[model samples]
Target: MRRVQVRKTHKLFIGGAFPRSESGRTLVVEGANVARASRKDLRDAVRIARQAGAGWSGATAYNRGQVLYRLAEMMEARRGALAAACRGKDEVDRAIDRVVWYAGWADKLAQVIGSANAVAGPYFNFTVPEPTGVVGIVAPAEPALLGLVSRLAPPLVGGNTVVVIASDAHPIAAVELAECVATADVPPGVVNILTGLRGELAPWLAGHMDVAGLDLAGADGDAAELERLGAENVKRIVRGKADEQSPYEIAAFLELKTVWHPVGF
Candidate 1:
């Protein structure tokens, strides 16, 4: 008898662990049953992200960069698997390179994004970028791996934990990437990915008071409503490009803090 090939259960990645949706729901996509996350699951992810973000944001910038690079290494090791999951090898390559690119930015962002300012009073003042905390991301639908990676990397580099709604039609790549994150030395809850209907999950994330930043790049038709909900908590909302590679991307998920020191004679 031929050995049977067992199918892998595609589940939601939360707090560095894979678990079935609390609602025990699954949606079949491309003949594969993927976990369909529920509102309760979204709430859980946000709570975990908030707790994990403190330690992540407090870590040295250089350390964050190393972790990102390690993720890139993990992605590289899984290149063939990633290529099979979404799009093609080109996209997987781009996603890996993008992770590495953001890794490079982690240590240098302060130099490029911060500045000392001349003040009128007898004091010294300078502004530095800090993590926004518990950023919620809606991953775009096309070029699945690359687009998702593009949005995910910037926030991770900037030290903000993320709860991303992976592309609805193509979620395997997100789960695969989560596997990379799991082995990349990332702290639990630093990056959580949920595979489900964007329409259902995104609204909850948008209105979540604990979510300090919301990236609605893939919110599409629901962007207006989501933005409105996010406004209630004064979230830093951004609809960034799917293929963008800029320091601004990292800055979008960050908060600028200015410190003042007295220079009295």
Candidate 2:
């Protein structure tokens, strides 16, 4: 008997579950129906990220590191699927490597970027890094999987939950990476991935009051406008380049908090 091929449906990854866009729109890409998220979906994603942010950010840095390492493991297990989606194994390899690289920084971030104060007071003061809550990302179009992973990993490392708008032209890889994210045991709403036109999704995410940071490496046209929107909320904005696997990149998604304790207790 001749076998019939079943078409796969790609939907939005929100709150740790796959759901179709609230707008009921779809874009035909790579011979599949990829959900085209609307501003409503973006809002929903941000809400989920905000709810999940507290738990994820409050988790011990070591635990966050281990969770990221497991995500890298899952990505490795799904290498074939990810490679197929992106049309290249090199991209998948680098993507996995990037996840692992950021994972290693998760626990060490405090020591690396945090500092002890040298104040001339009868008190001990210290500055530490804390997650900036929900982060928004505009992933690059080229290098599909690698680009998405590059921008996504740093925020995860910093314990900041994210809602990313995937590359419009090439979204299959982002969708496939969401699979790895789901199976990696990440908390619900910790990382949400939306597939849609950046033009449609980015502005809402940038302007969202709950979203603490915005990475616009892939927001092509009108990025300046998005930056303007972000400025309104005092959102930390990254508009120039791809994410490198450095603690500094993680720091960009974090806020430094300082506290003092009386020394003569």
Best by TM-score: 1
RMSD of each: 1.1, 1.3
| Model 2, residue 48: C-alpha shift (Å) | 0.6
Per-residue lDDT of candidate 1, residues 213-248 (tens digit): 999878788999999999999999999788999999
TM-score of each model, paired residue for residue: 0.98, 0.96
The stretch of ten residues in a row with the least summed lDDT in candidate 2 is 239-248
Q: What is the TM-score of candidate 1? A: 0.98
Residue pairs with clashing backbones, model 2 = none
**Which parts of model 1 are misplaced by more than 4 Å?**
1-3
For model 1, what is the error of residue 13's alpha carbon versus the real structure, in angstroms, after optimal superposition?
A: 0.6
For residues 118-225, write the lDDT of model 2, one tens digit per residue: 999898999999998899999988788888888899888899999999998899999998989999989999999999888888889989999999999897667889
> Residue 224, candidate 2: how far off, in angstroms?
0.5
